[model samples]
Target: MTSIPKTSRRDFLKLAAAAGGGLVLGFHWESAEAKIMNVIHGGTVAGSDISFNSYLSISPDDVITIFSPNPELGQNIKTSFPMIVAEELDADWTKVHVQQAMLDTKKYERQVTGGSGAIPHSWERLRKAGATARYMLMEAAAKRWSVPASSLTAEHGVVYHKESGRKATYGELATDASAIAVPADVKLKDKKDFKLIGTAVRNVDSKQMITGKPLYGLDFYREGMLFAMLQRPPAFGTKIKSVDAAAAKAMPGIVDVVTFKNNVAVVGKSTWQVNKARKALKVEYEPDGAAALESTTDHDQIFKKLLDSSDPNVVSVKRKDGDADAAFKTAAKVITKEYQCPFLSHSPLEPMNFFAHVRPDGVELVGPSQTPDMARNETAKLLNIPPEQITLELTRLGGGFGRRLKADYVLEAAELSSLIKAPVKVIWTREDDMTGGSYRPAVRYRFSAALDAKGNLVGYKLRGVGINAGNCTREDNFPSGAVDNLQIESIEHKSPITTGAWRAPITNFLAFAEQAFIDEVAMAAGKDPVAFRLDLLAKAKTTPVGAIKYDIDRMKGVIDLVVEKSQWGKKKGVSQGFSVYFSHRSYVAQVAEIEMKKGKPVLEKIHAAADCGVVVNISGANQQVRGGVTDGLGHALFGSLTFKDGAAEQKNFNNYRLIRMKEVPAIDVHFVNNGIDPTGLGEPALPPTGGAVANALFKALGKRLYNQPFTKQEELKGVSLGERL
Candidate 1:
């Protein structure tokens, strides 16, 4: 048995009253030297205190309840995190209950759920929590039986003295355990002894979701709550000039019409009524210098100008090693190509919506948010109230591809509720969500590579241009340290259109550009794509040039696994493309099989190999990988959010195409079996999907796609592939 580290004395466990008369336990990690204390104190338990920092509780009937601290945005953390605690506690899996914790930074540190960091950050702490509680329960049972603690063994929430044949249930000993002092140090179960950690446990909320239960933000409703809709500026960089709401206010079910800083608000009894009334309201906007902006023409000129500019101030060096210019000048052969991707919309199934009730005492917000603490703090600042006065309840999010990280929708609901002096639920229609700004920034990349006479890679240079958001290229991106002469430069182009993180952030475009260019280089060097990448991985593993952000061994691990699983070059009938990338501390490699159909590449299947460390829920992890692959394929095929005269051109799914079931292919996912701590699986699987598909298109059609949305409507109509090829 390996002993866990001892906590300091300042760390105390509080046993308080819980709802339904269960045992409520709260623990806090205040300092580095803090340890769980033994003192038991009694006081009137308030509703908030019942669950305040109360991660785990045992009921009188031996039922254990675990509170999940992180906000769940369909990542399955609610089920996975509880399994970590249950494994260490040796609790009965069937007897466990899971609940979502409120946003309280004091109790739960770093409650934000972005970057796929919840599992790694909470692994050790949660295991320690469960171990501490198990030790306390065993000690209490041993003391009552007048035996050495070593004689006791716990299994399935039962503490038994094997020698004396005396057994006590955890619920039966809860009262005594509450008074026992927490052990300074406790032992943790080894990986080989894990029962629930690696097991296939169903999602805690799966039943509720399948049964159409009210678990999402849009399902939330309160008595006497009014529905509100905002008639925002038609385009970016515009403000309200005048408003006319006479006919809107007179409409049936319409309550009132109000003007706000950016838009007009229509309040009514239902979402439909508010939307109907909002459509009837007449409003004029004052252009704010963005009315002349156009995505199709202006952005093309902007990117071209930036690429051709001689201003040194516009270009920033992100990474450099040796002399790239000299290597390129003296190279035996050089290959240069340019790639670009348009802006994208998240387009989550459930549009942005929130419910807020503001009063003199405090403000209560219930909705789906990726960053509840940030939303609460921002709302507090806007309302001129203390942060403590703002209460935020997180509901299950339909889908958050990094869009929910922004608290603008939450703040909007709070502001409207404050002005109306009533509980209000603000709903953003599909049009509002699609047309609203904060899209994924459009990016362009120019890649040049130099190779020696022996076909050995020597130099690589990349110059990237992104809109408004500075650089979309990472300094330590893949193949950075793999080459001796390498340079990465980025230029920023200002735009009025707001931009933000998409599913995988900059890696979404960066991986597509880098991997596609790598494939082209492999073709030019007369080497297999997989073999070429493996050679680079071996170089990075043995002799690296600079700081290596990724583990070379892990990179090789996934690539080899994917090559074997995909049967690269072994499949006789299908054309395949291979790609591997690292992001969010996880490595994923994908092989896409495609065939040309009506001059467009039709996906046949995608085989993936991932090394995200230990697998928590095999079923859920596979689902995530499949979903991510599908999302990446969908967007890469024909997804683009464009603008003309500062207004979004694609206002709905009809034009802004998403992958349908017919378009998605069967995905076979495999994971590396190792003892490494688990990394996030939500994002890493997505970045390589695009690259794999693009490479497969080239293999199938002998054409290189320099831009995204590789297949357009005209191309799909059996147009010749001669133009792009």
Candidate 2:
């Protein structure tokens, strides 16, 4: 059971008086402190000076509107977030309305939604918002009936006096409730009493989404809005030298052409017209000052050099425990392997786009942004306007996968709008979206493990090399805490190629590298992969080394569950592989079942066990886990983004591969309901999937794959869902 700290009744009364003495029934809660007060009365807002710090509003007619403060990047936070508030409020599910709140730092904390943080960040505050409103309703009923507030119980949007057989709907008491003193503290429902959280609720926007409703940033429209398409440098480390837009401006439907920074923008009445004109524009490029013009070949050679280099300038120790050198010296066997994954394009279904209306007095911005607060701040800095003068609204994002975290596209729209003195919607074509340099950094990991003559693991070492990846090693994750002697180091090459977070960030590929290497070591030790991992976990639980950031129990729980669900060793004719990872404070374990068909490995199914604390909207949670697994598997199988002379070789889907329906394996998702606060679900399941599949592939192929895009290998090339032999 959880309890919310109360704001004293006396303090709330003082706040009401300060807000002109009307009924103010909500508290502006921030990081365990109720700093301000706000209220709405009879469906009209009452406090202008007050920051609406709460997530919900109750009006006459008992309608409750819950505001989802974070961006919905196809993660279903739009539905699940409000479900949490409604559950705590004990409000009727049918009567709850959810709205996407605009960017307001004071009203909502942590408006950014990347890193699977939306639920974990806002969980307690949303629950308290509901409880507070429920408390107010009960107080209003107590005042009307001349009874003690404690004598009335609130449930399902009603205040009831059981002893007297009296009841009042929240709608009937809303007006009076708005005037009641805000409660300082309220009791939260225990986990056993959760009514809506564990249940599967369909996406709130499913109906609108399926019926072709205009909901995404691409669907956004304004009466006089102009469409824009930009021509950026053809390759990384290049900038615009000169532009010839006369031919583009002569095209029909093309309103104007402009240049800003390194981009040339063609603004027109429609996307089609702008795209046609954009192709007509002639632009010259020059090498950017001091930025290296690199290619995939260059990066490959660089990674190899850095992995071998001992220069302190190239390698930085991320974590070091007992001397690894001594442990390896006494070991009977040493297993060394190198794993590589290429830079990847986010390739969201909806390409990058945003709408900006920059006016003299204020700015009206609307689009799909995973970090609206960051976008707003960056836009303010670019436009030389106060942040307060900007109003940003969020639209349903088609997909993000961490690409929207950057405000580059948002700034593009704002800059064009400001220059043209009109509202503009900046749209990136599929070619632009893919070739644009904000890619997942190409990374390589070298792992060496030492085992004693008795077959017990003694030492582990990792050296990571990456292009523009700030920190490539997850120093504290897994084997770090379990191993006796461990050393993790990172080597970075600052390429001119831009890179940023993609899904689970470094863990997306690192988990695979670490787990695959662990599997190899287990094989060398003649131990079952599952049993080997469990033994290490047990050792860590009993006597951990250094600092352990992950919850051992949670990780073990998922591993056990996946083993049971996948029937690990019981299923014949199928090669089985196991992997578990902890990220974003959530644990996920996956088992991939593979079978050789027509001399190639075909992934048959994946069984996944996730411990994301208490499940909120089980349907959405299942989809998230399954989607992450599929994404990870597809990328590992056939995704690669290579550069030739700093130009991305793959421009669109034709060359850049994605999983097809036939190739996607069936996935079973199971969640552990430990009745704890929800952690992130968006990225946790993704990290372990690649490792699981690769381990399974090893079992089926009798060989190890050391690089991603397993298709790159001569034998695995064109591997797909081949028919069973």
Candidate 3:
């Protein structure tokens, strides 16, 4: 179980009279008797100055409203967080309503939601808040009945005294409960007593989403709001030379055309008008800086140069164990392999968009952002205002995948609003978004291993290189403490193109390379892949080299579950491959079944076993694992993002190939149930999918694919399997 920090009790209470005689619950955290009160008071309405400090409220009509503090980006945090509170409060789930909390740094210790950290960070805090409320309500009921609080029992928003057959709804006692002081220590429910925590509940806004209601950032609108579109530079590392806006200004509904640092903006009355004018606008760029970045071929040459050259300045040691040089010297067998993966785009369903209203006193912005507080601070710095002067709200995001972590879009909206001197909305077209270039940096990996005469592994080494996307190295990753005489080194090359996190980040490609190489080593030794990995895990459990961040027993549990569920070594007619990886504090194992269809590799089914501690929502957890498998397979089979002249070659879906509906396979997901605190599920399931599929393809076609997008253009044609064999 994860340990939670202890909070001290102090004078952190402040109550304001709420409209409609509702009861507000305000919680403050104290460390060593230093009190910091965070309070808010206002009506429950859209676009109102509601109190930011209040997280829960009870009205006179038996309604309980809970504010969810994390950002929702289709990972279902909005539903999961409130369920935690309801479980502790013993409130009726059906009578509870959820509201998205505005960005308030003081009110929430952390408002940013990325890396799948929200649930773990808020689990203990929210449970305490709910328990505190329930305690106050029980005290009020005991005072009214002239009985001890210990004799009262609260269940489903009602306090009952079985001895006297007396009961009162929480709403009926809201007025009296509001005056009671909060208790420093409250008893929390045991796991066996939970009713809503592990149950599957539909998303709170599912009805609104299906009915086409306004919920997403693109769906936001305001009266007198203008629409704007940007025409960014054609390539990276280049600035706009000149702009010809005469033809665009003559278009209907065009408002104004202005040039900014790297792009030109076209403001209009509606999105259609702005899009039309943007197409008509002409712009020239100075391409001298990006002259060397002509193609992916050039980037590959740079990577090869870095890989072959033994430049001490470029190489940085990430981790080392024992003496790899001595172990390799006496090895009987040595194997080496090189792997590469292309850049990728987030390509969320909804393109980047935000609405901003800048004024002399402050700036107000509403949009879908993973880091709302960071956006507020950056906008403040750009507008020359205090961070408190900027107000930011989070809407439902179509999808984040770590792309929304960057506040460039929010900053752009604020800057445009300040210039236009009115409320404005900035929208990015599909083409603009694809070419905007905060891409998942392409990476290269080289691996080497040594084995003794008995086929026992002795030494391992890995070197990686990438562009701008920090070192492509994770020291605490799997196979770290598992292997003795291990060394990991990384080199980063300079590139003007912007790069950022994508899905699992470095683990995405690293797992693919590492696991695939492990499979090759196992095959060379004539050993079962599943058994080989299990042996290593068992060895790590017994004698680990350093601090093992992952639990080897938990890792082995998921692997054993997957192997059993998948019926390993029992299939006679189909080819199958297995892989296991750990990341983001979660363990996942996957198996891919593949066969030939029309001379191309076709995935028939996928079996996955996930051990992410306790499953919050069974249905949502299943979908997350399923979606991750599909995403990983699609990218591994045919997804690639190339560059030409420092510009992305694939501008839209037409050029960028994604997995079609017909290509999806039946995915079977299973979870290992252990009552521990929940870990992240958003990214751990993705890293193993690629390696599983690649190993399956090797079994079917007798070919080893060194590069990603395993099915090349020539391979897509009708080629006989016998020829490759």
Please tell me which predicted candidate would have the highest TM-score against the true structure.
Answer: 2
RMSD of candidate 3 to true structure, Å: 5.1
Could you give the candidate ranking by lDDT, starting with the highest? 2, 1, 3
**If the candidates were sorted by their TM-score against the true structure, best first, what order would they fall in?**
2, 1, 3
The candidate maximizing lDDT is 2
lDDT of 1: 0.82
Better of 1 and 2 by TM-score: 2
By lDDT, is 1 or 3 better?
1
lDDT of 2 at 275: 98
Global Cα RMSD, each model = 4.9, 4.9, 5.1
Over 1-725, each residue of candidate 3 has an lDDT whose tens digit, in order, gives 01011111111112123434556665532111111122222433222333344357676666777667678998888888778877888887788877777787876767877787777777777777788888888989999999999999988889999999999998888767866776667788887788877778888878878888778899988899999999997777677888899999999999899787677999999999989899998888887564355568877997888877677888888889988888889889988999998988889899999999999988899999999999999999998899999888789899988889999999899999998898999999988889884788888988888888887788888888887768898877778887788898898987877789999998888888888999998887678988888778877889898778788888998998999998987987678988899888888999988767666656788899999887777878898899898888778877888988888989999989888777788899999988788888988899999899888877987776667876663433354432111
Worst 10 residues of 3 by lDDT: 1-10
Model 3 / residue 12 / CA error / Å: 21
TM-score of 2: 0.94
lDDT of 1 by residue, 1-725 (tens): 11111111122122223222434555552221113322222432323322235357676678776667688888888888888888888998888887777677777776877898888787777777788888888889988999998889999989999898999888888767877776666788887888878777788888887878788899998999999999988888777888999999999999889887787999999999999999899998878864455556789888888877768888898999999999999999999998888899999889999999999999999999889999999999999999999888888899889899999999889999999899999999999999984798898889999999887789999989998767778879679888999999999887778888899998987888889999999988889998998898888878999989988888899998999999999987588999999999999999998766666556788999999998888888998899989888888877998888889999998999887777678899999887898988989999998899888877887777778876663323453432212
TM-score of 3: 0.93
